[model samples]
Target: MNSIEVEHLTKKFGDFIAVNDISFQVKEGEIFGFLGANGAGKTTAIKMMSGLLQPTSGTAMVAGYDVITQSKLIKRNIGYMSQRFSLYNDLTVFENMQLFGTIYKIPRRELKDRIMDSLARLDMTKQANLLVNSIPLGWKQKLAFATAILHKPKIVFLDEPTSGVDPIVRREFWNLIYETASTGVTILVTTHYMDEAEYCHRISIMADGVIRLLGTPEELKKQVGVNTINDVFVEYVKH
Candidate 1:
């Protein structure tokens, strides 16, 4: 089943088109990567799918809800974590989790158990009382991810989720993403890291507000006659 279906989705700011009639489908439980350089319309496209921005033309169905007509329902069923950390630095780890749970409307009876389970999985139970500002960057990213999915949404949108973290931390973060995907949660992520793009089951590369390349990592390399996704990206996006 396709968890996401986009058809001719376009976004325009007056005469300038940020996303030009782009379309794609993401399979259920798939790690679908949206990759591109800055100003390539990746962010615009993701914002449309997440119901955070309205498209100028066309439509998309995300988590079985229409992007235009059913945007509210779409938002409720999808989790989103932006490039900037979403947690409140003054709040404790558990407090941030609690706040997000309430925002998602998780039942009070189940919220505590869910919070505990998530912290345990990350080996972060001990740090639950620590203020978010005091925790390490890597741990904060993990917490942000956990909070995003606290409601067990059908789909999650992660925009540059591991942008500035170290290699080891990024690897650990991807492990969490994989574990989330294992349980049938569809993941749509945007990133500039070529190595991270390779981790995705399939990827779409946007250039000049359109998808210039789309396929699995191996297929893309073979199609472009390149040795790495980095080279493939340069071939299509830089030129």
Candidate 2:
């Protein structure tokens, strides 16, 4: 089943078009990458898909709910982690988890078990009580992801989740994303990292409000006759 289906999706702010007539589908349990440079409209497209922004035209269905007609249902079935760190720095990790759980209206019993499971999976159980401000950037990131998926949503939208993070930490984060996708939670992630783009099952490249290319990383690289996605991107830019 398709976890995400977007057809002729477009977004405009005043006279400027941010997302221009893009169409794609992300299969259930798939890791789909949204790749582009700054101002390439990746975030705008993501916001539309997450039901955080209304499209100027076209349609989308996320996790089986129409983005326009059933946005509340879409929001309930999906988890969203933005580029910015979202957890309250003043709150303890445990407190923050509980807060989100409460907001999502998850039962106390299920929330407790889920939080513990998430911490254990990341080997972060020992730091469960630490304030978010006290944790290192990488650990804080892991915690943010854990919190985002605590409710076991059908799909997750990660908008540059590893931006500004260290290489080792970023690699580990991708591993976590793959592991999540393996468990049947489809992931739609936007990234400026070329290497990370290669890890996705499929990717779409955007530029100046339009998707210029869409294909597997291997296929994209071969089409450009480049050895790396970085090189392919350069070729794309020069073309």
Candidate 3:
């Protein structure tokens, strides 16, 4: 089954169209890479699908809720993490998780247990009491990802989730993504790192407000007559 279905999804601001009539579907448990250059409308499309923005025209069903009308429901069913680390810097690791879990309305007692479990899974139980700002960049990224999925939302939006982290950490982070998707959570991630894009089950490259290519990594490489996703992006987006 498809966890996200977007058709003719367009976003406009005054005279400019940020995303123009894009369509795609991400299957349940699939890792979908959303690839594009800067100002290529990736963020705009994500905002609309995540219920933070309304599209000017077209339709999207995210986690089975309509993007235009049932946006609230869509918000409740999705989790989001960004490169800038969305968690509170002043809060300790545990506190930040507690805050989000509470916002999701998880009971206090259960939330505590779940937070502990998640921390343990990240091998971050020892760091639970540390202020988020005190942690290293890599750990903070992982913690942010952990906190994003605290409520186990059906879909997770990862925007440049591993951008500044090191190679080893990036591999470890993708492990978390795989583990989550194994249980049927859909992952829609926007990223510039082509190596990370290669890990996606499928990817779409957008340019000038339109998707110029959509396929698996190997398919894209073959179609573009290139050797890597990076080459595909360069060759496809430039045109």
Candidate 4:
């Protein structure tokens, strides 16, 4: 089953086209990488699918809800984590999660249990009382991810979720992503990291507001006669 279905989705700013008629589908349990250089329209497309923006002309169904008419429903069924730290710096980790859970309308009693369970999963139960700003950058990123899914949304949008972290941290973060995907939740991530892109089940490379390549990492490597996704990316964005 597909968690996201997009058809001829376009976003324009007056005469400038931000996202051209792009169409794609992300299947349940898949980690889809949306890659592009700066100003490549990846963010524009994501906002539309996430219901933060209205498309100029096209259609999108996210988590079985229409982006145009059912945006509130789509918002209810999705989680989002960004590269920028989105949690409250002054709040304790547990408090931060509690704030988001409350917004998601999770019951007060159940929310505490769920937050504790999630912290235990991350092995960060000891740090629950720590202020979010006091934690390491990597740990904060991981926490942001945990909080995003506390509601167990059907789909998650991770915008540069692994950015600015060390290689070891990135790997650990990917482990979290894999664990979530195993539970049949779809993830659509945008990143500039080529190595991280290789970890995706499939990737779409965008350039000048259009997708120039779409396939599995290995397929793209073979198609481009390259040995790694990094090289394939270099070949596309350099043009």
How good is model 1 by TM-score?
0.99
Give Cα distance to truth, residue 108, candidate 3, Å: 0.9
Model 4 C-alpha lDDT per residue in residues 40-134, reported as the tens digit of each score: 99888989998999999999999999999999999999999976989999999999999999999999999999999999999999999999989
For candidate 3, give the lDDT.
0.94
Give TM-scores for every candidate, taking all chains together and pairing residue i with residue i: 0.99, 0.97, 0.99, 0.99
Kindly report which residue stretches of model 4 are placed more than 4 angstroms away from their true locations once superposed. none
Q: How do the residues 1-239 of candidate 1 rate in per-residue lDDT, one tens digit apiece? A: 99999999999999999999999999999999999899999889989998889999998999999999999999899999989998999999999999989988999879999999999999999999999999999889999999999999999999999988899989999999999999999999999899999999999999999999999999999999999999999999977
- Using lDDT as the yardstick, the better of models 2 and 4 is 4
Q: For candidate 3, lDDT tens digit of each residue in 130-174?
A: 999999989999998998899999999999999888999999999
What would the per-residue lDDT of candidate 2 be over residues 109-183, giving only the tens digit for each residue? 999998988899999999889999999888888788988888889999998899889999998899999999999
Model 1 stretches astray by more than 4 angstroms: none
Count backbone overlaps in model 3. Answer: 0
Span of 10 residues, lowest total lDDT, candidate 1: 230-239
Worst 10 residues of 4 by lDDT: 41-50
**True-vs-predicted CA distance for residue 82, candidate 3, Å:** 1.0
lDDT of each: 0.94, 0.90, 0.94, 0.95
Judged by lDDT, which candidate is best?
A: 4
> Which parts of model 3 are misplaced by more than 4 Å?
none
